[model samples]
Target: MTIGQWYNEAHRALRTASTAMGRSRALAAADINAAVIARSAIYTQLARATALLVGGSPAAEAPDRARATAILARHGQSLTQLYVGLQAAAVVERQFPASPATAVAGPARSLRRAVDAVGVIGDILASHVPPGQTPRTPEGLAVRAGGGVQSGLADIARLTSAAIMIDIALPGWLDQRRGHLTEIYRPAAEAARWTANSRLSAVARELIALGRGQPRLHGLDVARPPLNPAPPVSTADDAVAAVSAARTWMWQNPSELTSVHLQLGTQLGLAVHVLSSTGDPTMIGGWRQAAIAAADLRATSPVGPARDTAAELTEVLRWLRSIGKGNHGEPAGRHLQQVSRLNSELPIMAATLHKGLSAALQRRDLFVKDEGVLQRPAGSLVFRAAERWRPAMRDDDVVQDLVRALVQGQDADSRSEHRSPSSRAFPLPPRPRTPVSGAHWAGFDPPSGPAVRRSR
Candidate 1:
């Protein structure tokens, strides 16, 4: 072949190789997204299935899949929001056919919608952040300005893993609803974590490289995480003491309770994780028992208002107790409104536990001799847990800004008509229509005062 022909062939080959590499990366990105979507679908389905089994109707016709795609394209979107929306839908769906233990269902949905709307708006506004605003990676995504690289990735890794485990084991978990989730899902969850890690491989690498000021970064980089990771369970008595202080702070700031509860649930979850990692039969058994108790508490029918938070707090408390209560810590937080049966006794109980845990560390140990004593290793766990346990609640300034921004951002701000989903710029699942009351079904007023009532 002539030199001209050879030169053309080499150029074409180089182009082909470059295109192939880009194609591979694109495919990996797609796979990560697919995994997330798959997980969300399973979550949504499980909720629907559970609702059906419990005599609840489907929340809303699952939006036409094609239509949903079109809607998503027209509006700004995020994987996290989409997943969260599906989760919210499933949770709301499950909460319907309200049992004795749930919140008074009717009026609360608007609040939930508003919360979701705020979250979605956060994603949307985040998208609009000017490129010049913050330090952007080569791929042009913001980095979490704060913490250790592994922590953020680890958060995604752990959360994604936990979700995957739940998705995988959900059917079984429901089928044997009485079984402890720790028993049913823990092992599978640990394994699923690696799977989540694998999915996040690309994102994690980008984060690491960025932290090190590497020149190479890509278009698909995830957003920067906060400086500190989401808090974990405190293992130290001192750390536990800090948690108590945080609770006291939260109590004074009642508005912060919801965030506290979310944090507590997370800490309790992480505590179980740390405990389980120890692998001792006793610790594992404690974790299992705690898990079972938690599952049982939440499984009770009629998970009314405080009962939900109560159940969650109780789960945390039970685990703490199982671990020998090296430090007195109470499971009080934002989500915990007054638990119904407590008759406002929870604070007293917490105070009492606080006093009990304050005693000599060895004395607190029901464990043999020094066996229960939290030594250097336990100290690290405690400090890490305490540091991580601090709630990321931004109730006042953060929430206010978000609410104002979303409202002002609405296309329907001036319109009297109700806003459509598209106007909000998020793809939140439809709120379930309120179940009509019996009075509405009868379509007639009951006899009123002065016995001027209708004849029976």
Candidate 2:
């Protein structure tokens, strides 16, 4: 079948699955199994369709591709919500098995069909690749081959991260939830674990094959060492701690913030490309809002490192907008190189931000009422700090100033004589004074400091 034909097939399958899911919602107690099955089908089809569309050929008609991409994104989000709902239902059902015997038959049949449909879609995409395609020049060949290797490595990293989340992180999180594990859910949970492990192993082998097939690109393989290590952050506390550590590191190593911003720009540019490809207005609007938020952060920031970081963020957002408008070539390639250089740090930083956001949302009490005001600015600061601490940019003055200000602010807030309206409005939380390289400060101070300024 042609790529367009396959897209039609995917569309039809997705529609059928979505209809089933919708009908399942109104199903009686005995048919809850059917509802779960329908939801699984919907999730599978949406995921498959979205994946295929993302990797779709550039030759496909723009309008059709755009429409399909929009559908996939819209359905993808809905199916994710449904999947979450299914998980919640599973918890409820585990305690009181509403027709346990009914679970295996209907769900098994529905899932089999869904899996077969996905396999067919994958096969079609895989077979549709043009044969005998080779780069015209050695440089072109290297670029093509090196991109494959980088993509393969990225896939491996993503898959490994997902596997870790499924195996270690998820179970740990589930343990925290009440009534998460019951005898009825054990079989399904075990099956999911087995399936995830099997898939991970298969994907890993494929990624290794992909990497091996690509010719060695000399410059690409030479990775610069990281300035500082980024430990994995799984929880809110861990994310907050990582942010703190990153802040201290950046303060001591201010020059590194520029490199951090460059890396961030690359990542954001890539995201813009992906979102633009989807042609979904809502998604594009959300991206624009993020850019606007960055701009606002830049406008409101003080004349120090915070403003500098915000300005860098705004510049990146503008670059990303340009990339979306098809103004990419050498500049995009340069951005990609920056990403490659900071490959080790980028994932950790992304993960930390994701976790931190999730933590903030889940525990509102941990953040102030207007947490949105601080989120981007604080994040920029942390990113700048982290990048500075990284070996690529080893300057620490920016981060040191941040630490000094934080420490001084806290101290000033403590002294009644020094309290001011501005400080009162945005009071620094009290923290124990600790010295950063003989300079006294509060909380997690960097290893060293320059001249300390007393807060009025």
- TM-score list, all predictions: 0.18, 0.19
Please write out the lDDT profile of model 2 over residues 1-456, one tens digit for every residue.
Answer: 322243344444444443443333222433333333433343344334333323422223222222333433342243222222222222222232334444434322333344454445444333322123432222222233233333324332232323223232222222313353434345434433433343333333444454553422222111111223344432323322333234323333333333233233334523532433222343233333332322221111224543444343444445444544544353433333222221222222322222222222222212111212223454365422221112111123322333333233223223323222212221232221543223232333434443342232
Worst 10 residues of 2 by lDDT: 385-394
Candidate 1 per-residue C-alpha lDDT over 360-451 given as tens digits, one digit per residue, 9 for 90 to 100: 11122211111123335543655221111121112222222222222221111213122221111111112113311110112111122221
Badly placed stretches (over 4 Å) of model 1 are 1-144, 148-150, 172-456
After TM-score superposition, the amount by which residue 441's alpha carbon in candidate 2 deviates from its true location, in angstroms, is 26
Please name the candidate that would achieve the greatest lDDT relative to the true structure.
2
Q: For candidate 2, what is the lDDT?
A: 0.32
Q: For model 2, what is the alpha-carbon lDDT of residue 21? A: 38
lDDT of each: 0.28, 0.32
Clashes of each: 20, 14
Per-residue error (Å), model 1, residue 431 = 44
